[model samples]
Target: MALHFRTLLAAAFLLVPATFAVAQDNEPDVDCDNAMTQMDMNICAHRDYETADTELNAVYKKAMDAAREMDVQAKDMGEHYVGAVNALKRAQRAWIGYRDGQCELAGFAARGGSMEPMLVSGCLADLTRKRTAELKTVYESEN
Candidate 1:
């Protein structure tokens, strides 16, 4: 009877660790894949936003360059090339305003919480990616 009790105790100890190991396996490693910890998540969110912002900057430059070329061609028809480029600049400025206000609104979901910045950054990343695609489309169709 004592031997049986000892065996049960040994099995229980082994079971606990095995279960814990399995649970840990499901969690992402902090090396590259995003870990769910707040710090890691926040870092990952900012990284994503930075990448999106970088892409947006590149596309914006290309689109602006296309506008300049279009304006140059329009000059032959006695139409000012500066007009179209100026219009695009105005649109881009308005977009910047909209993006800021929209992200601020999203941050409200986590207002006063530690995750507010993450929420705002994530929203910015999403919107920036979409805007990059839109700019690319316009640039493509124009040229």
Candidate 2:
């Protein structure tokens, strides 16, 4: 299973530059204002996803901290926090699986093409933005 996963990963990387005229290591500095080539578009999309992921991480941390504090207060009151923290951890794990699976499906829509990575990354960014909003709601509710 591990070997299969590694092989799949390698195949995905091979598709990353399959259609791009530019070499993998020579991806030019992207100018989102004017992404002229397919490679540029893919690069820009991946960067956007990275930004979304970073924001999601920040929101998740804040939400988890809030959950922890609520657990502490519940303990002081001789009641449980209803497993809020554990529930969040579990939900997050499930959401991660859903996100990766969704993106992989999207990538397969453009299978063996340079645009596959871009499609996958765009799906990731869109889902991550929604997840960040959901996490913020938990943080707000705890306040």
| Per-residue accuracy of model 2 over 1-143 as CA lDDT, tens digit each | 99999999999899877756457556677898899888888989898999999999999999999888878878866765457799899999999999999999999999999999889999999999999999999889866
Question: Model 2, poorest ten-residue lDDT window?
Answer: 18-27
Candidate 2 lDDT? 0.89
Tens digits of lDDT, candidate 1, 1-143: 99999999999998998999998676544543845777677767877899999999999999998888888878888874347688889989999999999999999999988898889989999999999998897579975
Model 1 lDDT at residue 65: 89
Q: What's the CA error at residue 127 for candidate 1, in Å? A: 0.6
lDDT scores of the candidates, listed in order: 0.86, 0.89
* lDDT accuracy of residue 83 in candidate 2: 70
**Model 1 misses residue 107 by how many Å?**
0.4
Candidate 2 root-mean-square deviation in Å: 8.0
TM per prediction? 0.74, 0.77
